[model samples]
Target: MFKSILVPFDGSQGAEAALAKAAELARLCGAELTLLTVYRHHSLLEASMHMVRPDEPADLDDIMRTHAKEVAERGRALAAESGIPAPRAFVKGGPVARTITSFAKEHGNDLTVIGSRGLGSLEGVLLGSVSHKVTSLSETPVLVV
Candidate 1:
């Protein structure tokens, strides 16, 4: 019954499971699947600043964008090969939960699929869990795979 399904991926195994589930659901329902990958811009910048020497120059935004694009490409390819219709790829820079919720609202997606991980209990309390946040905050139905 879903017209549009949004699947968020991060090149992790958990994300792969979510993508597979979303692809199957899309195929079964003849729905359009959208593969979303949110690049944690702030985190990446902080990481770059910590890893790189102060004197060294680095384009943190560009680097993170490239990585996000690659992750999206991989997810898109997998969905396409699995018989999901031409999956659209999106890359955003923000907190994962906010980005996902905003995308689902903006796209009018019937369903949002995301993997559970990355944010453990301690991390969830600190940074928050993307999947849990989306599930609790999203207006649309969210399936954590």
Candidate 2:
């Protein structure tokens, strides 16, 4: 019974699955489907480390933002192919989970369908995945696919 559904996409297999599921839900409920892709703003120090030249410099944040837009558009296209009437897509630069939850809240999304790799690695077990963080941070209902 969602009026609007949000799916965070990052060109990952898990995210693809979530997008498909969200599209199905939106179609069934006659709801709006939204796609969001978030990229982290790279620190200057981190960006500098990969520099191969002293004269020429690269803007990692801009590069990431541009890539994020492409990913978001791809997600939108996928949703359209899934038979959604129109899927709105957005790209932001920030911490992924917080950005996703904040976008959902800001857009009045009734439901959020996110993806999880479901990895059982010690790092994930100790730190948790983005999906887990989204569930904890979001006030709206979240479905992890």
TM-score to native of every candidate shown:
0.87, 0.89
Per-residue lDDT tens digits for candidate 2, residues 3-93, read: 9999989888999999999999999999999999988788778767767555544677878888989999999999999999989999998
Runs of candidate 1 exceeding 4 Å displacement = 43-57, 118-122, 125-127
Q: Which 10 residues in a row give candidate 2 its minimum summed lDDT?
A: 117-126
The per-candidate count of clashes, in order, stands at: 0, 0
Count of backbone collisions in candidate 1: 0
Per-residue error (Å), model 1, residue 37: 0.4
Residue 20 in model 1: lDDT: 92
Query: Relative to the unseen true structure, what is the C-alpha lDDT of residue 58 in candidate 2, on a scale of 0 to 100?
Result: 67
lDDT of 1 by residue, 1-145 (tens): 9999999888888899999999999989999999899886656557567466776546677888998999999999999999876799999988778898899899999999899874234657786677888898899899998
lDDT of 1 at 139: 94
The models' CA-based lDDT, in order, is: 0.85, 0.88
